[model samples]
Target: MPDTGRTMYARVVEHTCDDCVPVSYELCAAGGLMFIRWTDRTGGGKPVVRETERLISSRAREMWRDLLLGLVR
Candidate 1:
């Protein structure tokens, strides 16, 4: 069976961040980077969810890509 727990957790994280966050801080992110998601911590429904895919530094991108790959198995 799929890792329902992990999937649910990820979805919850996205929902909580989206619902709690305000709507003003929603920026396209700085340096071309993106906010995969943020919390209401800013009281701004800001984008709270973004990704440039290209903005991420090369090294960090590789690391995260590897990490995600590992998670699949």
Candidate 2:
């Protein structure tokens, strides 16, 4: 069974640094909600994952674009 605490996102788009950076972000969506998942591997073992609060699909997409443009962190 699927985990009740975590909704399954059907799509995930990853944005990663080109220079072997250990950090990356993923745009994820489930039902009507969307959010960004941040992943870090700088700790040297076992990457850590964090997720932003859910947002409207459009807003999340915009945030993703802005992140690519270096507007938001």
Candidate 3:
């Protein structure tokens, strides 16, 4: 990840499959936005990475609050 000049946190999850290619997801939060990345190797080729970002909104914050409150499962 490139330096964004802000404090950030990242979480990475990897998955392996018997019938499909392995894949990973990276989630990062920094500078008031959420960054999501997905990586995978298809057809035995080089790894592919796709990334996107979303602004943190009040609805998202409320959803997080509900998650913390055990209202979302």
RMSD to truth, every model: 14.1, 4.4, 8.1
Q: Residue 7 of candidate 2: its Cα lDDT?
A: 77
Report residue 48 deviation for candidate 3 (angstroms).
Answer: 0.8
Query: Least lDDT summed over 10 consecutive residues: which range in candidate 1?
Result: 4-13
Ranking by lDDT: 2, 3, 1
Q: What is the C-alpha lDDT profile of model 2 across 1-73, one tens digit per residue?
A: 1123467544785566625778888787777788888778889898778877778988989989998899998
Candidate 1 lDDT tens digits, 1-73: 2111222122111222245535212212334342232223353344233322323445434444544456511
* Pairs in clash, predicted candidate 3: none
lDDT of each: 0.31, 0.76, 0.49
TM-score of each: 0.23, 0.76, 0.42
lDDT of 2: 0.76
What is the lDDT, from 0 to 100, of the residue 72 in candidate 1?
A: 18
Largest lDDT belongs to which candidate? 2
User: Which candidate model has the greater lDDT, 2 or 3?
Assistant: 2
